[model samples]
Target: MLRTPAAMQDAERHTAHNYHPLPVVISSAEGAWVTDVDGRRYLDCLAGYSALNFGHRHPTLIATAHAQLDRLTLTSRAFVHDQFADFCRELAALCGKDLVLPMNTGAEAVETGVKVARKWGYQVKGVPAGQANIVVAEGNFHGRTTTIVSFSTDSDARADFGPYTPGFRIVPYGDLAALAEAIDEHTVAVLLEPIQGEQGVVVPPEGYLPGVRRLCTESNVLFIADEIQSGLGRTGATFACEQEGVVPDMYLLGKALGGGIVPVSAVAADADVLGVLKPGQHGSTFGGNPLACAVATEVVRLLATGEFQHRSAELGERLHAGLRALIGKGLVAVRGRGLWAGLDIDPALMSGRVACERLMERGVLAKDTHGSTIRLAPPLVITAEEVDHAVAQLAAVLAD
Candidate 1:
């Protein structure tokens, strides 16, 4: 651990103290595993917060990125790049939407969705000018943008970040009646994550998503599903919404869409919704550039095969089952779908942070959220044996 201390200090010395990171200093990684500066390997259960659904340094994604790098990388939105068309078309088709607006980050996609929804409210829904309001859920995590955080319920993310933006109504997540009460004629949209990842992978009540879809349809309000952390085969299906057989008016997608190779996010909707933007009204200079398009297009191709989605589903059953068996043995609860899970440890025994540290010592890496919950999202490329190994390590940590 001699080299690790200096590297950790160097990491914190120049960077802002925005994150409380694990104490390992990783220097290289492959599928399902990473090697630290001291050459200690750990099974990666966090999977870059579900961004690396395909795993670290996935061969196909790296190859595509390399090929694109040799040809071209960036171009302004003022002009079209060669790889733009296929990327947009395939992604739109995958989402079953007619139009797409690509952006560089998940937050930008959310901001774009907010703008588009409001514009559509003015132009299409005929809400009074400057009166379009949005309904958001409590314990939701869309992004860290000022506008997004204005409606957030987390004190750490929301506090001291004001003067906050306005025109949003917050309601308890999974309360169909509360959500219904929040929407009205002035409401332009309902923004939510189908599965609240940061809120300990909290899945809403049964039929809640369908209820929200019905409510939005009945009120003519756009339903914006932020699938950044839950989409692209993370939750067994292509989307978490599909598990409930619900489709929103808009899909804010990112994370695995870029194959964890680049920062790429997008807003997908039909022409009537996304087309509300005129030429100069909304654009990103680095959005849909050659490199992003090329790499993301291949990413689309990978998802098109449906292999990852199926793998996640089959393996997810095993993962959840394994975690459930440990419920009374230090684990109090386990919640999630597919390969994603939030395991709640017995608080009397240890904090989630301490559990993670112990797991690191046992050669597994995962992240904790809330006070007692740790989220486990191993890469889809991980084998059944790897999953067992990760579970075994967690069991050992708890046993100690």
Candidate 2:
């Protein structure tokens, strides 16, 4: 087995240099802990960017996947499989939506939602063809597709990725007035992340989501929530939008929906809204594959129990209380919801990347986004003791 630095160098030389990941190589994971190539263990505070809400290799999900694999892996949407309808029904029930369109990735789900919104705008909302407008919030990271990136506010993601797709309007996040002002007669939908995770877990101002819901309803515009990273109990709720008790017209869900095993995502909406697309209008070959559906069905059931959500809420309070106690010492601020937290370091102290490296050296793993903010989202299965250990390691790094 090699040390982390050696393995990291190998990846840098062989893999695409797209991500500036921490110099740690995990070889195995279970629950909230991971083992590096060198056999060193660390608390996985990042949890694959909230893709492991059920934790790594959750027994239920793995068993379901195994059984499904033994029975059937993929049938492609060209043919329906036994697992498809069950998955869709469970997901729709969990979401309290009328219908669900499965996809393989978060970006694909987002694309599905975008297509639905645009089509609904034309066919149902009666907006002119090619004139539909969707208002998006600033600092959003919906996906990497050209159309999705077109509305991105991050220069790094959008730079050199154009000529971008059109039909989008940008408004400052958490600013209801600006959002309302941006809406026009051609506006078909308003898309936003209930909590901006990629932007360092940037939670909106209180009541922002509720206000947006009202605005969308009043203006007769569809409200679409990109909950790819913040949904599925990541924010102490089935969906972050639920915190404000507002239901969007459609939901873009991914990340943990696959039970941290496969890439499973979906767009859930009412029949009239999602029904805009007739057969042959849109789909993916592996969208409703038997394997993904089998796994996701279990995932949806797990979310329905509210066990993970309650765990996140209780653990989040403890984690935040611990991190918040460090504020004004070395941490500038800590902001986030549920299991997700962002520790903003003071400029005078080490940068988030630096702190992350130091914490890794002390047996914990978390990722830094932007420059000064470290985002932590451990698997929901992590216990209070493990949370304490991770936080203690971070505190030790700050003290050093």
Candidate 3:
């Protein structure tokens, strides 16, 4: 027996069952590939669910992280660290927003967005106190926080975790009519993912995002785009909304914002919407710490250059073309934008889990979202040949 089985057993024995990861034990990773302890290499198609958009241990990100580690690391929210202002200012400028509130995770950013929206509704929009509600889309995967999950339509995420928080209304995704009907006088914000990553990378129909933007504008409600998984150059743009020519009231960002080095998330919005918060209202301890800010500032600068965005756009077309060619063979459908794609393997052949297991055996690492749907979000730094290699592995797996 190889060393992997024993390592896998040890991992399962010690950790919680929150994630059902593949059996491969990754020892190290660089760019678009990872190495197992047993010396096997695998193409990384998941890219840490878009968190590794810059690829594993990107040189610039790594250098900044290393330098920050040698200096100060944390100072909490009480005293502002040296790295905080640059990160907040640069990230805010990137989003075309006036203010940015840093947080530790995507879920915290969502929660912060919710709180900010409610506060803005009461303070700015003049909604009735305690009657503030937010509109959300079905099949959304914001995060697993109690408040965030309160609006979730997924039973797996919402069930057993509730006695849920109130003040959220669920509407069908990609349906402007349903969304318009769901919003009321008390509705403060409309929160949605431009592309639903966890829900099989579902893309809304054309004009859906712009329509949502229009409705939110007309209704005087905030349009908060949860771009945690779709932003930071994953969708051929700094944000997926940019593809639709829509600028939301707030941008909830995470994942790639930390350059896959540290946990960093933020809610960016204009002064009018984000300024509703006073000092004591909301904060995070390690949110804009020196280490996180050092890495993420470089992340913002990289994004500002628009290099990754262009790469994702060009590479995404090639990826989608390759995937669409396989639709009639083993894939039922392929959906996504930029470097992100969700492929539905024919269920008659195998489930997404089985297909992923087979792909792993063929030296590629991908993730399954739904029953027969697997998501492919390789790093933006991946090469054309690597893309072809990953697709070829999938083709071979399906053929077998």
Candidate 4:
């Protein structure tokens, strides 16, 4: 018998019941595929929620990690390492920003962005001391941090988490008029996801982001784009904001930045906004460690070449076209851009969890979110054939 059952039971017994993972116990992965302990291979469509945007164990990223591991890893931000400056500089250049503050996870970057925005509001924008507010979309998913969840519109994430952190105003997403009305003299920033990944890969209306940019500029409020999930090569551009030709004042980035090797995230902005912090104000122990910098620098280099972005753009057309054909068949709707997509299966047929389970039985790995919606964010390294294969598996699952 395979060790899969025993291993899974052991994991369940030892760990917190936070995540209800699929039944597969993967032993190894490469590119866009993973193998179970039983030697069953499955196509990886979730792609670590876009963290593996470069694909599993990418050669360049792995090599960089290996090289750095042989020499040094963490320095705790106490002293600068050799890999630090280049990583910061290259990422800053990529973002068209003057500075980059590194953090370990997407949530931390969001928190960091919040802190900086508030500080900027006080020091630079002359907002009242404790009255600084941030306007966020209703269905936004920045992360699971306390401050982040405080403003979350999701009951699962917000309920029982507080006496929530104050000063955040929630407004309906894609409503330019509502957002404008919510902003006041105390508004410090407008934080939003260029494409909301968790809310079923929700894409806002076309002109929404550009309008936000204009409003933020006029109001002297920072426009912080939470690109943790929608950035990198997932949306066919380095950042999803780039799709709308909107450059936010601050970019909160994570996921693919670490090249699937380590937890790495950063907030990038120009000197005027980011410079609000002095040395002692904000820091992370493992933020810009040697191993993370080494891996992320290589990730930046990969993005700089624009190969992955191009692949996502071209392949996304094929993926979207294939999915759109399924709308009336079993899918209720399909929404997203590039290699990222959210498919809503007809709830009468199956829930998103059931659909994912069925897809898994057919040798595909995916994730479900919000009722009957399942998200597909295959790595940029995935081939056209693999993309078709995953879709065929979904069709088969739905047909059954």
Query: Mind giving the per-residue lDDT tens digits that candidate 3 earns over 51-100?
Result: 99999999999999999999999999899789989999999889999999
What's model 1's lDDT at 59?
92
Candidate 3 residue runs with Cα over 4 Å from true position: none
TM-score, prediction 3: 0.99
Provide the TM-score for each candidate, comma-separated: 0.99, 0.98, 0.99, 0.99
Q: Compared with the true structure, what per-residue lDDT tens digits does model 1 show for residues 1-400?
A: 3799999999999999999999999999999999999999999999988889999998989999999899989978888888999999999999999998999899999999999999999999999999999999999999999998999999999999999998999999999999999898999999999999999999999999999999999999999999999999999999999999999999999888888889999999999999899988998989988888888898889999999999999999999889998999999999999999999999999999999999999999999999989999999998999998899899999999
User: What is candidate 4's TM-score against the reference?
Assistant: 0.99
lDDT of 2 by residue, 1-400 (tens): 4587777777899888788887778899899999988898889999989999999999999999999889999888888788888999999999999999999999999899898999999998899889999999999999999999999989989989999899999999999999999999899999999999889899999999999999999999999999999999988999999988989999999989988889999999999999888989999998878988999999999988899999999999999999998997799889998999988998688888899989988989999888989999999999999989888888888888
**Alpha carbon lDDT of residue 247, candidate 2?**
93
Clashing pairs in 1: none
Q: Which ten residues in a row have the lowest lDDT in candidate 1?
A: 73-82
* Steric clash count of candidate 3: 0
Give the distance in Å from residue 173's predicted Cα in candidate 4 to where it truly belongs.
0.4
Number of clashes recorded per candidate: 0, 0, 0, 0
Q: What would the C-alpha RMSD of candidate 3 be, to one decimal place?
A: 0.8
- Total backbone clashes of candidate 2, pairs 3 or more residues apart or in separate chains: 0
lDDT of 1: 0.94
